[model samples]
Target: MSEKVVLHYFNGRGKMESIRWLLAAAGVEFKEEFLTKREHYVKLLDDGALMFQQVPLVEIDGMQLVQSRAIMNYIAGKYNLYGKDLKERALIDMYTEGIIDLLDIIMLWTIETPENKQKQLSNIEQKAKERFLPVFEKGLANSDFLVGNQLSRADVHLLEATLTLQEIFPTILSTFPKIQAFQERMKALPRISKFLQPGSARKPPTDEVYVKTVKEVFSHIFK
Candidate 1:
């Protein structure tokens, strides 16, 4: 009895990528179905195919799930990707949740208007990034993995977030050496390395300048 899992994704980078990587790394069998903005979701909603009316949904053995994080947690628990002990599992959640907070800020910035974007950078985002770095840096410094001594689902989630952010928000990781190293290590994982292959069709950042600048900053920090 093989389980069935289907991922609902849109064009470009978003929560779908993390789910994709986690499932792929675990060697899980699933289908990737993409939806466009115009009428795709409408059709799903009309037919009740997308139970939650949201994307990145994973259907497992006739059960449908929505919400990106919850889907990842479900996959992690299903595949034994959660931490070894209670404490390690908690740590994994802690670090993974912390990274989520950072990504949230970046996502908000991604959709902001130019004037308000600068305002966000200064008034909210700038301070927020500085605050989160120490926590992520310390987490990486504390152990080889975020939740356990070995690789866990939390690492896959956060590592993908970091990679996406390095291209989308480079300034945030500019001074964070531990996180830089962490990203490098996670990317080098055999399972994870497969994601880096060309022709992924992952969406590019709306701002190329920001992407280039951040890549340069990453190089500087790693150097």
Candidate 2:
């Protein structure tokens, strides 16, 4: 039986990184259809292919899946990455949702204008240190994984979120030793390790401007 899974997203990782991680970790073979140009995505929207008017659309077995989280959950359910049972699934959702909230803030740094982008970066630094880090630190205080002993979608999501933060705020995770270790453990996974390698499509593009600005803004901590 041939199962076809096609993922549509922008050329960069953005919201699709976790989905890529989940697919790769599950050893699922899929094709990436990059919507590189605005017209490409506009065509899809005009065709009504994207119900939610967004990218990160996954086509599996001829059915279109919209919403990044929904696509991830569907993939996870198929691969058993969601959880062992209902209770575990609930915990997985909780952790994953919390990570998504932090990711939302980090993504705001992508704003085009320098002033707004700088403000977003500052907000990211403040929130990561004050609100997000402590929550994950306590959550992972005992377990290596977010939900259970084994890898779950929550862990995958968290890893993507951490890597995204690391791109701009390189030293942000230093204070959260547990998350630092968790990141290392996730990166060491054989499948995940391959996806993270240089030149891998799963890697997001480096925003040089964002990196320089963040370094300057957080020079005190970096020093």
Candidate 3:
């Protein structure tokens, strides 16, 4: 049976990009339905009779799947990307959740209003970088990949999550060289390298610019 995967994403990379990468990795044929803004995405849902409030929802066959990581987990399970061993699968979840936490902190700065943006940055700086980066840095040092040495879904999610840093916390990763190198290493993977090519899709302008400015401010304060 042929499976159809429709990925609802914005212009640039975000949650959906990792799912895109997973589909590519699994050699799955899917359509990329890029939306412009939150409104455009909402309209698509309305037109398609989609019940989800978010973009990055995947429609497989006749069923709709909401949430980016949920899509990733579903596809990964189908493709056996979760690893062969139970312990390895648990480790994959460990790394993927860690990346998700990092994303939440980073998004707080990007999604907040300009007047209160700095305050959000300060909170992420005080809490995330100081508290979490070290632990993640140690994890990266423990293994070449996030979970196992093999390319699991955890590495794929981590790679996609780290890309956000270039626009969200560039300097934070600079302080933790291991994580920085891990980002580079993931990009070097042949499958991931495909997405790193110039002119690859990007996140929306609002998110891109806001995250870039937040990273700049955080760099100065953290340094």
Q: All predictions: root-mean-square deviation over Cα?
A: 8.7, 7.5, 7.2
- Candidate 1: where are CA atoms >4 Å away? 1-4, 123-125, 169-174, 201-203, 206-223
Model 2 per-residue lDDT tens digits across residues 1-223: 1267888775555677778888988888778877645566678888788897776788886678899888888999999898898999999998888888887766655634677777677877898889777888888999998887788988888888888888888988888999999999999998888888886658565465534444443345447
Candidate 3 residue lDDT tens string, 25-124: 6667777665644455547656774565555678886778887777788898988789878899998887788877877667555656778887776687
What residue pairs are clashing in model 2? none
lDDT tens digits by residue: candidate 1, 1-223: 2266776665545666667777877877676666644365666678676656666666776777888888888888778888877887787787778767776777667656678877776644455456766677777787777655788877787776777666645676877788888888987877667666775434455464543433343343435
TM-score of each: 0.78, 0.85, 0.75
Better of 2 and 3 by lDDT: 2
Better of 1 and 2 by TM-score: 2
The candidate that wins on lDDT is 2
User: Each candidate: what lDDT?
Assistant: 0.68, 0.79, 0.69
